[model samples]
Target: MTELDPVIHTPARLRIMTALNEALEDGDEIAFPALQKLLDMTAGNLTSHLAKLEDAGYIVVAKTFAGRKPVTRVAMTPAGRGAFRAYRTALLDILGGSR
Candidate 1:
């Protein structure tokens, strides 16, 4: 049996990773506000989950200015993509065993 990634196994984190994996193309990023809206998570809740993913080296959060306004962007790192793939495989394996 394969071990699941505890960091991504949490429901919120799982949703975050899945969203990133599905939404992003290579080298593309999503605006923080857009991601929050898509996930339907409160700003604080999204930030908290983002911190966990960042700590795990699974995502990058960049804050910069768009003209005079502050803008935040999020992107999955290569390591994150690989981790997500592994997590998906582990989940599939677990489900496969039940049949």
Candidate 2:
């Protein structure tokens, strides 16, 4: 059996990775507010999840000012993208072999 990535396995974390994956593919960054809206997560929830990913070196968090307002943007790192792809492959392998 292929081992799944524990970091990306949780439902909420999975959703987080998925959102970041899509944005990464589009060569775009997701703002904290935007990610919260996309995932239907609260600000605190989003912040915690993002912190986990950031700690794992899977994503980069940048805080800058948009005019006078602070803006937080998150982007998946190359390592994060690779990990996600590997996780997907593991899932597919399990499903395929199960059938």
Candidate 3:
């Protein structure tokens, strides 16, 4: 198995993608605070990477009014999921996963 080339893989972006991929596994929407806490990232940091992901059509951001407050949720798109799976597989291949 071939590894994913670093040309399209960045550490920070990979972290963001991994987080979204984990969230999808549990059938729950990811909230900003929750994601921030999980990633231990600042708002600015997250925004920059999220912008890249959003621009790539890998994730969708939904905004809604929760009574008086606004709710923002991030969900991985199908394309995102597929890409993440491939990325994971490639990474494992690079690591030579135990058979």
CA lDDT, every model vs. true structure: 0.96, 0.87, 0.78
Residue pairs with backbone overlap in model 1: none
lDDT assessment of candidate 3: 0.78
| Residue-by-residue lDDT tens digits, candidate 3, 37-56 | 88999988987888788778
TM-score-superior candidate, 2 or 3: 2
Off by over 4 Å in 3: 1-8
Residue range 1-99, candidate 2, lDDT tens digits: 799988889888899998889766644688888889989999998888888888989889999998999999999988999999899889989889432
Best model number under TM-score: 1
Alpha carbon lDDT at 52, candidate 1: 99
What count of clashes does model 3 give? 0
- At residue 67, give the lDDT of candidate 1: 94
Q: Which 10 consecutive residues of model 3 have the lowest summed lDDT?
A: 1-10
Model 3 clash pairs? none
TM-score of each: 0.95, 0.90, 0.80
lDDT by residue for model 1 (5-93), tens: 99999999999999999999879999999999999999999999999999999999999998999999999999999999999988889
Candidate 2 has an lDDT of 0.87
Name the top lDDT candidate.
Answer: 1
Candidate 3 TM-score to native = 0.80
